[model samples]
Target: MQAKEAAEKLGITQRMLRHYENEGLIEIDRSENGYRRYSESDLRRAGRIRDFIATGFSTREIKSMSACLSDEGAGPCEGGVIKMQEKLEHIERLQADLDARKQAVLDRIEELKQGLAAEPLEL
Candidate 1:
């Protein structure tokens, strides 16, 4: 397949495909006319790359997961689970920080509401 068809099938833009290539995520062959040629393996790898990005994995992280990204059978790859756990832990920490901030904002709003109730409106 060509770049357009591959991009369409992957539900990503051609620019994203190029970006993935530039990121060294996948390698695409060039045709006689210098057009990009995507093989099934390439498309599968690109799809995995897209999935990893959607899950908030950076290209660097994905690069580190080369073992999991291979066309080999879908068995557990060493370090893949560790990487996912690390990402989950990172997200959990972020969620905790956001929760604390949200609680602070809510507490401030409640304090302001109480103050407004205690004060008489002066027009």
Candidate 2:
């Protein structure tokens, strides 16, 4: 497949594909005429790399994952699983903190309502 075809299939820009190639995440064979040729496996790998990037994996982590992807029969790496778990846990903690802040704001609003009703302001 050509770069344009693969980019269309993956819904990513051609520049992004080239960037991935430059980073050694994906490789393309070159024709004798110098046109880049991508294989089916290369296309698949590009899709996975894009998916990982969309999910917030850092470029370093994506590079680490590319190694695991190179293995023919290997499943997802333990390190990748651990990193995703860590990210999820961090998100959960953030949600909890946000919830606490929201509740505090609601409580403050209710307290203001009560205090305002008791003191009947003169405008």
Candidate 3:
């Protein structure tokens, strides 16, 4: 299929396909006229890349899972599981930090409210 058709099917833009190719996530073939031609395997790989990106996985992390990204219908990749666990841990830490920041902001707001309540209103 052509780049446009592939991008449409994948629900991504052609530029994103090019970005994936540039990121070395998937390889696209060139037709006789030098236009990009996407094979079934390429589209499948691109879909995986898109899904991983949506799930917050970086291109570098995806690159490390090249073995699992292969077309071969192998069983579950243990390395992929490990990577997911690591990502989960990272996300949890970020969530904790965000929670703390949110609490701090809420506390400041409460303090400001109390201070305002203590001040007398001037006509």
Which candidate has the top score in lDDT?
1
lDDT (0-100) at residue 49 of candidate 2?
A: 84
lDDT of 3 by residue, 1-123 (tens): 999999999999999999988989888889999999999988888888888889889999999998767677234775988888898999999999999999999999999999999999999
Counted clashes in each candidate structure: 0, 0, 0
> Whole-model lDDT, candidate 3?
0.89
The better candidate by TM-score, 2 or 3, is 3
lDDT of 2 at 1: 78
Q: What is the overall TM-score of model 3 with all chains considered together?
A: 0.94
The 10-residue segment of model 1 with minimum total lDDT is: 66-75
> In model 2, what lDDT does residue 63 have?
86
Error of 2 at 1 (Å): 0.9
TM-score to native of every candidate shown: 0.93, 0.70, 0.94
As for TM-score, the candidate ahead, 1 or 3, is 3
Score residue 22 of candidate 2 by CA lDDT: 88
Q: Rank the candidates by lDDT, best first.
A: 1, 3, 2
lDDT by residue (1-123, candidate 1, tens digit) is: 999999999999999999989988888899999999999998888988898899889999999898777677246888989988999998899999999999999999999999999999999
Whole-model lDDT, candidate 1? 0.90
